[model samples]
Target: MSEPTPQTPGTARDDRLAGKVAIVTGGGQGVGRGISLGLAESGAAVLLVGRTLHKLESVAEEIRAAGGTAECLAVDIITDGAPEAIIAAAVERLGGVDILVNNANMAMPLPLSDYPDDAFRTAFEGGPRVTFSLMKLARPELAKRGGGTIINLVTSAAVRWDAANYGVYSAVKEAIRALTRAAAYEWAAEGTRALNVAPHAHSPGLDWWMENNPEEAAAFVAGIPAGRVGDPLVDVGRPVAWLCSAEASYLSGATIPLDGGQSRWG
Candidate 1:
């Protein structure tokens, strides 16, 4: 199969979310970084919230360099009052929140039987707990904006049959999926849409796998009917950008798989 086309800088730029303010957790690296860039490129002032100040600054700088607005909020979202602080920062720094992207999560790869209590706690707090907190805190602001979009970054593993060692990971992700859908229904009257995106894109984790296990990585890539991993910015990010826009107003409480046909093919 031929390679997926590479996207050049500013090639697909548009003002789809212009004048809007978006809060993206873990916006410093991986898929979060790409989503931040995509949102900025589409004309939203992004508040990049994460633990690493430098990484957040770096992504924020890239947005500024591209003539997009962004701000860095370095904090551990798992901490108490962090959600409140994040919402406050977005309002103070970038105006009210019109979009909230719950994209940060940490789940160790372990079988359900072997998963320790500490590891499980870490995963639960970081994923579903934080996501729930942020969504609850941002609801009033999102509603105040007349309408808003909440994009929760879930995992395709939640739906895959052969979870194997991904048992604990999938459990937390599934919780996020449930929270998103529940919010979608509960907030329907308020014009706030909540949805999930399960993305299979190139990231540090995938790079580590490819470098350490080339054969396995190759077979994994081959399994994807698209013949390659999805691009973080173009494949995953662009669609997310569109999803947060008025064009997707009709969409809510749905999990969109950005896996290059891997979900269906499997």
Candidate 2:
């Protein structure tokens, strides 16, 4: 286990979550898409939740094309009862829950004072609130499965940098990280597991940034240790699969950083 190498096979879709059902919030695009597909690759019945029905459908089709079972749920995860609806859909369609990836986060970067209350609410909807609500819903269901995994996908930049303007969003995500650890400790005896995957990969957020500022995007990539952005299937994909797999059975409540060593320099 200490061998500095992955025990699983390469990038081909594997059956790690063979009998599992997973719900991925904001599964339409970006980091959420990466994690959703990863779980599907592991053979989990994926529930892709997002505001964009078309995008969610596209992802679902891809999963089906790959011969994996998937379904699309379109709704703002921040909406009241959205999480509950998602959980219900999984139960009705796939039977039960085995894993959950909280991948929905409003990435509206703004100063603390300038950040509107509604924006803060939107951000919190995905950051900590959704996580809390989902866990509350999944707790009882996980017991029936004998155990399960709840993964929170936070951002590494929030912890490693001092972005004065980004503090509001960071605070919400940091709360999720804290919750991840707390849940890990409290749910240990209940056969429940939780963890945070803080990724600094080139996701839809980065693409938005680059599209707005080509210079800044180029500079950012140039500064990376690997001198390149992360690949969802290879970089972000593998770690997510591992965490959702039995191979990482002993891990829980870990705040893992998969940022191509971005946090290492600091």
Candidate 3:
């Protein structure tokens, strides 16, 4: 055999993830879509999992059109056995997973006294519950790979008290932060990195919020430092790319705020 070929620095970029895969929950829309595409643009095959097949397929189509590898799976992650089905499907299709983006969040932002019991139940069931399940499912795969990244998509409300109107949503997201820190202690030794990304609301989700409650839209828009709402790709996507990349290899159990200085509001 010829002498072993010397590897060049740049030539190995694609293979940086040749055998790796990523599963992005709620990747059909909003920040999750941004994360999924960002990860794929970096050379990893991605599984976009969410409740809406149409949205998932749209994101998947974009990824494929852009020459990236992606597949869509629609699963109601809040149902008793749904998380298991979603994770199992991704694991089967991808063979093994190297990254997990816990962006699937459900929330009902209502005042304490006016909060709907069903809404609270949904948020509790969907947010922290699903995060826990996905992490548990991804653990062995991450261990097999010897290194992996888990970024939990969080909202700024989890950090700032008096955040406009998200009481119950913030609580579960806070629980998610605590959950990630707890997991960091358990899995850091296994070459796993768990982190939280607190991003300001941006994307079609915001649009829906605005449409549903247009009266609050202007007030919300006025507070942003950018003087306008941010774009999910540029605002939310790039930061997620960094957090998921080897650039963040040294970070674990960390919470990063991508809030455009809005977190400065008291």
Best by lDDT: 1
Model 3 stretches astray by more than 4 angstroms: 1-18, 161-164, 211-216, 264-266
Model 1 local distance difference test score: 0.90
Residues 30-110, model 1: lDDT tens digits: 899989999998999999999999999999899999899999999999898999999999999888999999989888778
Whole-model lDDT, model 2: 0.79
lDDT winner, 1 or 3: 1
TM-score winner between candidates 1 and 2? 1
Least accurate 10 contiguous residues by lDDT in model 1: 3-12
| lDDT for each residue of candidate 3 in 49-101, tens digit (9 for 90 to 100) | 88889999998888788777888888888878876776677678877788888
Poorest lDDT segment (10 consecutive residues) of candidate 2: 1-10
Better of 2 and 3 by lDDT: 2
- Give the distance in Å from residue 180's predicted Cα in candidate 2 to where it truly belongs: 0.7
Question: How would you order the candidates by TM-score, starting with the best?
Answer: 1, 2, 3
- Per-prediction TM-score to the true structure, in the order listed: 0.96, 0.91, 0.87
Off by over 4 Å in 2: 1-12, 264-266
Error of 2 at 266 (Å): 10
Q: Check candidate 2 and list the clashing pairs.
A: none
